[model samples]
Target: MLAAAAAAGAAIWLTTAWLLNTADHAREGTDRAKVRVDAVRTGLAAGAGAGAAVGLLLAFRRQRHAEIATTLSDYDAAERRVTELYNAAAEQLGSDKAPVRLTALYTLERLANNDPSHRQTIVNIICAYLRMPYTPPLDPTREADPEAAQRAAARRYHAVRGNARPAAQPTTTPNPNEERQVRLTAQRILLDHLKFDARVPWNKLDLDLTGATLLTFDLSNCTLSSARLSGATFHGTTDFRGLNLAGEARFDDTIFSGLTLFMEATFAGSANFGRAIFSRQTDFGGASFSMQTSFERATFSNVTNFGGVTFSKSFSFNGATFAGPALFSQMTSSERATFRGSTFSGYTEFNATMFKRDPAHELDETTSGWFDEFGELVFSRAADFSLATFSTEISLDGAIFSGDVSFRSATFSGNADFSKATFKQAVDFADAAVADLSSPPTLPAGWRIEPGEGATGLIVNT
Candidate 1:
């Protein structure tokens, strides 16, 4: 490029010097040469400028490629570091020392917090830790209690039969009390991500803590994709209030050693509590089950409530036993709700419970208008409301008891109506009670009220 510029400059200087030496009326050849020289210099200067611009363009391309390569290398290094830390933490979980295990859990938590992609995998690891076999601390109160001893024996027998636990922990394991703290920490970490926190929110976590022994486990106001807790044992009071389970919740054979509350929970998929034992007072009031729910063969040893529950699909409590007073008031079922061969050994009430969502009430039935607001009361199959108590005014108006209905030893309070009830076969309230005689309960044909059990006991009069 410099050579081109020098050639152009020399051409111009020679033309200027030649023009100075030209005659007043220069020859035609000299003027023609001057024009030729001027054109050559202009072309040389333009080509040099174009050449310089191309050089800079090539340099910029080289710089951009270098920057991209550096960025990619840095990214690769970061990923490797994360993988190393993750592997180390996971390995530490298997350590025999409680402190080492606890440290591992916290490290995993921090890693998940920083990297959202690893959150689900970390959650699974935490759950796997919880699934390890654990034995609870001995309760002095239950040490010698015969009932407690029986329950413990039954739990152990069932665990062995179901293969819910390993053979036994090695004698080299850490102290139970110290291990409990580590397990609790794991539980808390799982809960933190499962819950919705604005600063640290995670979604779509599936939990499978099956056969794990939990202590005073309470998971409230949370959402779960699916909770597979079958064969798990809850050692103390457990609560699952206001929980929304989008998928199935399996608690089959779960044992609750103390009071349990599942108030206002929504189970969108099948909610199975088959053979579950609730040893103390339990409440499942105001819960909604969109699909089938089963409590078959379950035992509720104390007062139990199923009030204001709605079951969109079939509900089965076949062979369930309630040893204490139970209430099933203001319940609605879109499909069949059967309690075939179940036993209610205490005072049970089914006040204003609707068997079917939409049913036609007999025009002549004398049941209160409350039944009209919801629907008719129809027990499709044989039902036992024996030893039942009525707390407030109840209306059995426009009700149809299709199968052999037994209200033996039932009591009534306030006003009762038995008008227009179609009893299919052998329907009778053998020893039902009425609270007030001045305003006697309405009884249908072949059914009359008489003094039965308690101060306000009732019996049937034919």
Candidate 2:
């Protein structure tokens, strides 16, 4: 539009100049001068009309563009102001002033669509305020001094601002039950926080879980310092990964279901789970179990990884079941450890699992009645009995320890596969089984069980 207007104005100015020149030329009496002058005058009037129309249109367009730009700038400024006001109000709403808190909440609701983080904080604060009881009716008599009244009001206001209340002097000797109630309330608050976001950091949190059922709990990346979780079920996909549990930690009847990960966790003091059940795949991978640790009747359902785990003192897993493949690969056990009545259903791997005690650990001698009652020393299911150096007399006397117990080139410094190896000794059944006993033993012809030497009662095909 502007371009058209400019073009029309230029034509008008040119036409007016030409007309005045023609009139002057007529006065000089050129041939056909009167006719040229009349034509110039008519062109000049038309040009004037065109110029007026173009000037009005150009002015109108400029005004319209200016109005549009102003409107946009105003909108942007208003948006920025609202954002600033909401943040300021939110930060101060936890103040003792009731009116300020109300205003902050209103601002949060107004800017809810624009920003969500501020809105969530407002919601949490409001919920907390609602939970507080308006009880004990402000004790004006208790405030003997005028200044005391002001201080009391100020403290009440701080409660709204998310500040912890200052501990007050007990009016009378306090009962232990009151202290217990306070701790219980704290624990409840922690659980509420967990329901919203399990990743909440609860550093230096102490809880008394006398009869808590933590079924299917997930405390991933949580810091539970001085937390007492006794007689609680740590069951069902419970994620305690990377947790630092300082002080006493107890889990007496806990059940682990599915992949219960305790990866890279630290246990400081006595941690006990006398009868725990690990139902599915569990990874205590890279966990440090310090102090006394006990797992007396724990049942492991699937493949379990105790790899890279460190036990500081006495550790026990008496009467545990490794129902599926169990891996103690590269695990370090300190002090006296016991795995007395454990059943390994699938392949039981103890490859490079280091122990503290025996050199030639017989299955029956050190640990009593493990193999004697169950007949076969059960190593039947492709056991990875590789490079596991036992420290004492370990027996596999009676339990059906079947499968191809791969002692393939395994250096057993103590009594090995002794009580009743279905496949005869020195048969060199490196890769062969007991079923091939009818034929000449697969051992090299010269290899024989030494007659009166220490390798006694050994059935070798000499």
Candidate 3:
């Protein structure tokens, strides 16, 4: 303000002196002096206003920086607190007491529920815990009832036969029953959070349950991103009904020692069950595979059902063995479905099935292009399809069949190419329908096709 006043007074004085005539300016000095005083006051006020504005701007900038610093400090402290809690809970998970372990799992679950950023990490920790070896108590009920005792005895017998028991001895917690419940709690936590209709579903989480021993494990009606159950062992009945897998699902070399159900499951990505063993009844009824699927070298020891299934991409059952009754009736496929070099020991059914393979999918015409076991499509055992439908060219060239083959009342829409196929047992094609008269089926020397049931239907006489 003082500098502004001095500069304003000097400018006003110089202007007044220059504008006045010599005699008149000398007489108007008092008036010029009065004008200079008012100009000094106006400049002082303008300078004071500018200084106030600068002070306010600086004050606001300082406040904003302080706010930002406070926010950052609070965030850092919260992050450290969360890390400390996570570490403490993880340490508690290794406690010897089952109750303590359960508490730790619940604590981690609560933390995950509160903070979504930590959900996948929490899931990984739980999966790692499950991967730790576990052998279920003989009877899951752990009761003194007669039924429980009998099941326990049977399990013991099986154990002696080198059948199961992949779990390692618990070093900290020796009590198997308590540990089983703890593991079950952990599994329950996952299920509750991953349920299809869960209040807060943890979507798009990956599961790595490889080599875990699960008892009556049910993850039905859950949507998962990816799953790895390779080499895992499932005891008791395992249910995966209505499950949805968004990414690749692997069950390679897995063992299902009890009833296994995968009903109505949808796999958007590649699904594999290579070399898996199903010791009891296994049902995949109403399941759909949208991508590549394989059951190569898999063994189904008991009743196996794949009824009402759909495969939109490449599907293979190459070298698979069915020891009991296998039902593949009422199934649909949009791509090549291979059963090359497979063995069926019991009654096999493919009633009202549709096998449609596009010509472009014919990777190898001479030999079926399997993942690792490419060979001619051969049915080494019994195969019965009372009312099935073959939609494309089925090449059975150079195939050798040793068991009974029946295709009664089945419809063939394309070339039923079996030029060099040998049937050692009785082959039946009673009342079958052939749509492609231009490309007749190639049969053996003694076999003859004749008119039968309908105008388009035919029968094979051997």
Candidate scoring better on TM-score of 2 and 3: 3
Q: Clashes in candidate 1: how many?
A: 9
Listed in order, each prediction's TM-score against the native is: 0.65, 0.45, 0.80
lDDT-sorted candidate list, best first:
3, 1, 2
In the range 347-436, model 1's lDDT, one tens digit per residue, is 566656655432332224565332211014444455566655543344554555656666666656545566755677666687666766
Cα error of candidate 2 at position 86, Å? 30
Q: Which numbered prediction scores highest in TM-score against the true structure?
A: 3
Winner on TM-score (1 vs 3):
3
Candidate 3: tens digits of C-alpha lDDT, residues 324-355: 88999999877877777777777777888888
Q: Evaluate model 1: give its TM-score.
A: 0.65
Worst 10 residues of 1 by lDDT: 368-377
Residue 31, candidate 1: C-alpha displacement in angstroms: 8.3
Could you tell me the lDDT of residue 191 within candidate 1? 69
